[model samples]
Target: MSGNEISEVAKGFTYLEGPRWHDGRLWFVDFYTCTVNAVNDDGSIEEIAVVDQQPSGLGWLPDGRMLIVSMKDRKILRRETDGSLVEHADISAHCSGHANDMVVAENGQAYVGEFGFDLMGGADHEFANVILVNTDGTSQVVASGLSFPNGMVITPGGKTLIINELFGNKITAFDIEADGTLGNKRDFANFGEIGDEPNVAKRIEAATIVPDGLALDAEGAVWIANTVNQKATRIVEGGKVLEEVNTAPDGIFAVALGGEDGKTLFLCAAPDWDEGARSKAREGRMLATTVDVPHAGRP
Candidate 1:
């Protein structure tokens, strides 16, 4: 869809992230607002849950229980049938930065990511790890040596896992073993050049493709939040741009393909990434446009 064709389905938030289309609704988390909300098919919004410490990613368990990433506290809270939030796992001991996004597999295995360093605080850069949260509430570091792992998706058949390394400027993949372990780590789609600088600000200013959130299409193409260019770029297995949808006036933070026909490309956008400025205002929005390919694979 063109920039002019994109419509705002919902507005009035700080910063929206982790866009998920499930059960006929578009669910997401508002960072500064500290709320988990969903916009129904009728255009009415609903407050599904609340995350005081700040919420990022959203996923569902095998039995259909909601799993929310409590960012600052470094814990995964599971919503029970009675609407109570309980700690599913504590990952602070295994992480140096706040927990970020997560992807739950078909077998109830959840892979999560973190900053690995203090980004907002202007700390030095460091490679992060992907923690695997089992169904029994046990957590382990499944994959390491990542430059800020953000949004991820498991293939439709659950054989491979694709991850967007935000600070690394590359789309990486891992072979999902039969035992729920990740092996054969390789760059699925990598492009641009950020140089060899480890200085966070210096590298970010020099980076070419700073990927944030991403979604997989039906044809194996990946729609990524190209933060460096502030648009959603569609790429195949190789680092080739198939299409670029501009979300001007606002930067696209996340992309998801979901709707009745699964062609609705939902874009999580904001005016800027200034946490101080964003936290004081509700300028965040959930914009969307229809595309040809529907959503596939795990969110």
Candidate 2:
């Protein structure tokens, strides 16, 4: 699919995040609205669950349950069959910042990222990190000293994991061990140099790009939501930018590959103003494009 011909799937949301193809529907989060919504194949939208805390990320357990990332309360929430939310994991112990986006593995292990420091509005802080949480309720920090870790994905073979560092303007990779541990951290792709000149880092909010929300295509390419630039970019295995698809003027927070054939790319975009005038007007909206490949790994 060419970037010039991509189309929009749905709109009219406030701060949308965490879009995943589950149960034949498009499941996502509206952070400002504090609700989890699903867009059915027939184009009908439905609210699936609600949480007081702002939901930032979404994932599924091995048994088909949903795991949501709650930012305000700093917790991972699990949605029960009866449609109630439960404390699946408390990550405040290892996270200096709030929890953001997450990716789950086949063994039921979820890799979550944190703001490390307040990026949105809580506090002026720094340092982002990644943590590992199991379905059994055990949690641990797998990587640290990161500058606002955001989006993440485990490769199809499950041998490696890639994370985006918002302030760093780079994608970092780690070797995934059989026990769900991370090692050998290295830069996978560098969006641009980190210093002052209006580059990738200066475009998006700190820790909003590199790791905001990400998806993997069937060809093993990583589709990154370029938050600052308001675009979706495809990166090959060697950290090369293959294509860049422009989105709305708002910040592009996350991206997901879904659709019947898994060729549709969904984007979670939101409006963000300067700190002092931060108001939620048109906060979240869903943008989409058609791609040539399907989503990699499990949906």
Best candidate according to lDDT: 1
Candidate 2: list runs displaced more than 4 Å: 1-3, 122-125, 192-211, 273-279
TM-score of each: 0.97, 0.89
Q: What are the per-residue Cα lDDT tens digits for candidate 2 across 18-70?
A: 88987777889877678889987678789988888788778888887888989
Task: Return the lDDT, model 1, position 2.
Answer: 51
RMSD per model, one decimal? 1.3, 3.2
Scored by lDDT, model 1 comes in at 0.88
The 10-residue segment with the lowest total lDDT in model 2: 273-282
lDDT of 1 at 107: 87
Model 1: residues with Cα > 4 Å off, grouped in runs: 1-4, 192-196
